[model samples]
Target chain A: MHATALAHSNIALVKYWGKRDRALNLPVAGSLSLTLGGLATTTTVHFRPELESDLVSLDGRELRPGSVAHRRIADFLDLVRNDAGITSFAEVETANNFPTAAGLASSASGFAALALAATHAAGQQLTDAQLSVLARRGSGSAARSIFGGFAEMSAGTRADGRDAHARALAGPEHWDLRCVVAVTTQGEKDVSSTEGMTRTQETSPLFEPWARTVDADIAQARHAVETRDFALLGRVAERSCLGMHASAMAADPGVIYWNPTTIEVIHRVRRARRDGLQIFFTIDAGPHVKVFCPARELSALRSVLSQIDGVNDLIVARPGQGAHLLES
Target chain B: MHATALAHSNIALVKYWGKRDRALNLPVAGSLSLTLGGLATTTTVHFRPELESDLVSLDGRELRPGSVAHRRIADFLDLVRNDAGITSFAEVETANNFPTAAGLASSASGFAALALAATHAAGQQLTDAQLSVLARRGSGSAARSIFGGFAEMSAGTRADGRDAHARALAGPEHWDLRCVVAVTTQGEKDVSSTEGMTRTQETSPLFEPWARTVDADIAQARHAVETRDFALLGRVAERSCLGMHASAMAADPGVIYWNPTTIEVIHRVRRARRDGLQIFFTIDAGPHVKVFCPARELSALRSVLSQIDGVNDLIVARPGQGAHLLES
Candidate 1:
């Protein structure tokens, strides 16, 4: 059996930082995000009874069996195999529209798409929430990619994590906001999100406070999303973004994701805000910065950002659709 | 009466951040620091009944009456006058040997020297502990600059901060550590230390946690200083620096003091340490970074830092003497 699916990358307004559970990939706090239309991942999975092991390919190149990428995908696939009650191995091919492992949340979209495709190929019927739960096993952020537009992943209290999954706050048509991404570098980040989060939780003195304070941020963001309050949303979003980075930075052998270009964009955006432009910036676990503003201010944001040095590429995105099977 | 005093800037190993009493300029926690020999401030105070008001000059430029610099000095002079029970206005001239307001702790030296000279010029003889309390009224960090070598400023319990004063941890000759400063920019930081600390205390969620955690860092740094343990000292010093900056960075609108070159130096220094060089770096709320190592590693530290693109200048400093009267 073979099937294909697609999912979009998400930008967290209220970020999910430290995880409560490592093995289950459960978040320590609720997170709010918007799916981006421009950046995406497409995946196809085929289960063959004759295959001795799972074969994984990314961007048209076959992943070697012993490589990290190959092993992670293989391990994720085992969950689908166990659920389907089959010994058969699968050949999985995942393609990202944007750069991989550059802090673009490729794993979010990759695993979400993979969940949909792998489940379909296994001939198993699962609801959206069920798919979200399954996707979370692959990556903590993956659960949010199961829903379009505004989504919130609950930091579930259950030991099994069956109750913790993403829910849609509003669809794409509910808001007309824009995300202008300034990609600063193409190189892979020195530390992965999993590695960074683990360190922050283990060593950062501020991690407990960070975890405690995030719920208020998530609540504020939720209210802003419900009322379409851009200013309120922007304030909470920037605060949340900086708070996460701050906690990570306090860890011993601290995780510093922002490069010089990342900081340049932040300063310029704040300066522009002082000049009366209604915009805010957020950075995930990489050097790139995403500037959030209303649709009408796109040109102004573009003009200001383009003037900055060493910005590799700019991608303008709007709220996009959720993960679904694509007929081939 | 007239007197001249010289004071050297002290860099905190365990930083002093957040204030419990803004009016008294009392720190939320005690801090540990190392006094530097190369950077200093010299001040001469002449009390003249002929002058209508305090005349303040920094370096060669005369400060306007209502100007921030002028008012701060004048207001501080008021404290000395009140203590000495005299109304005579003073002609105050302070000269910084290094860059002013570029995050080099000029205020620490300036205020400490002013406490000594202004008190001496007013014919008030006091102990060093009493001088520290007076210096703290000018600037919180100035309290620590009153003592030489490694000093610890206690976060005193008294509301008036009369009991809160710096005491010498060890004399200058106790440690032979070298601090190689990389001056990244000569420009003044956008947010002053006082303003940034206030913002962090008022708005940052992590501020409370940061304040709570600093005492342990101080204790560790103090222990390291006592035993001359470089590795332990380095660990806590870097953590304290980043933790303080992190708390500031999490504030609403965030008080980010780092420039592009600041981050570059940090990354390069961390990378070089992987090559087996025993060194650590710390930053005050400005663009410059100080690389700390043994005296023998000064050349190696210089060579590495000089190769950085935007490092403007490098100053090698050892432990320095405390504030003392300069014969004129």
Candidate 2:
């Protein structure tokens, strides 16, 4: 019997936008993210020799039997099997603790967790980097979600994307960084990351400057993390989020990701900047803003952010653990 | 007798966005532009001994004696008089055939014409380089506009900015390029180039990539003009415009110069790409699209572009001649 297995994917403060080498899923800039324990995905893998083809079901709903994600898993299985000289058909059942394909990199973290479970189900063990490369084939950001604490997805140099992998920069104890996920809109994300990135690459003039900042932020962030410099962390985080949004304005039929209330919340936080408040915000493909505040100021920041008109719910998240499995 | 002075200013396709060293007005990127005959400014300078102070007028309206533009002229007079060993205040009068301060780089042509007339009035024989450097103090883009045809404003390495001067790459008649200017909106620009470029230099993510694109476009545009290759000209011009817009997107309150009509015109032109039509569009600080079409396709493109809604007016322009004073 196969028991259910789950994992968490974190949101990046430094965004992953363009591909340096698309074939290897290598990004143009290195990205940093914080993993959260509260938000995660549970995946179960079942392998049977009797099954004719691979199938994937998410949250009790079977997806188009062989979609892009499904093919990715099948391909991974084929590779691992070939290396191990074993042949088999497998079924992957994955469900999110959050939402699937909902603009959150749930798929990134979801597929990454699935990769772990499926590979384990085949009785094969691999290093984290090796696992990340396998997961990146599913989604570029997923590879970064495999590690906890402060993580950096090195933009690989090789044309094949072999050097591209996520590495842990600092552990959770280094800084008391706290994130509050304010769920603004839970509806289908209007823009897909795939289309959004492509539009940004083709149209946004800000993309290059955004890339340069990532490098600068990486160095500054590392020092900030090492020295526990909350001010530096807040500044870098705020600037990175602002840089990503700037690219949004240059997209064809340009639209900002912020809802009316999301903007209001950001403003309130900005207003609090004068008080040396450590509150900063970053958003991905969705309208929600992941407000990063020091745990010491969590109560104060939460009170103000919660009062924002459109914020649906606020969840306080601390540092999360790396990938793991459930024992049967 | 009123002297008729018709002077045209060139527009840099690779814009002179930011001043790297502000005191020197040193730009970060070299820019290229075309002077147009249909759109220009005409000015006449006359010294009046009756007025205790210098008086300036535009069209038929008398401006404040202490106006900033008047002050600039006074300052220029101080420099010239000190350099030439002469002292006298002169009255300056100017008028434009096009809209003033409507984000059209009016000063580019305006100041160029004014500089030429003022020089003649002062009885100072000046070289084109001296005239260009003088015009630049009035407006950076104006320096380039002083020359006709393909021109570039070099971002000088010297601190004094003496090295920064516009040079003609080719005269207007070097290539039979047809331009179609589609007016999308007529109003004061929300962001001035000074404020906008400062923001871009400080915060734009696309700045570095934009700088690289400038270099590439300058080289390619010069080649296209020399070779009279319409395809290459269209390609480089469009890329340069897009690159310029990219910086705008990265601003804190990111906004491009495009209105809805501007978008429509660009899309229609792109859709027509499959028709083997040689066409490209460039926009500056206004919501207008300057389409670079081959001479043979000008009427056809104008006909198609005119059909788009919200377009206020469409004007056809040809390669322009250098600045000259028209005697009456």
Candidate whose DockQ is highest:
1
Candidate 1 lDDT, A1-328, residue by residue in tens:
8999999989899999988878888888889999988779999999998888998899999999989989889988899989998779998988998878556789899999999999999999899999999999998888999999999999889999997899999998899989998988543258878899999999998888888888899899999999999989999999989999999999997888877677778889988998999899999988899999999999999999999887878889999899988986
DockQ of candidate 1, scored on C-alphas against the true complex (2 decimals): 0.68
How is the predicted docking of candidate 2 categorized under the CAPRI scheme?
incorrect
The DockQ figures for the candidates are 0.68, 0.14
Residue pairs clashing, model 2:
A205-B246, A206-B206, A208-B205, A209-B205, A209-B206, A210-B205, B10-B145, B11-B33, B13-B32
**Residue B218 error, candidate 1, Å:** 1.2
Q: Would you give me the overall lDDT of model 2?
A: 0.72
Predicted structure with the largest lDDT when compared to the true one: 1
As a whole number from 0 to 100, the lDDT of residue B80 in candidate 1 is 96
Query: Chain A alone, model 1, TM-score?
Result: 0.97
TM-score for candidate 1: 0.97
Fnat for model 1 comes to: 0.71
Q: Model 2, range B22-89, lDDT digits (tens) per residue? A: 76567887888888777788888765546577667787788776787667666655555565564556
CA deviation > 4 Å runs, candidate 1: A186-188, B186-188
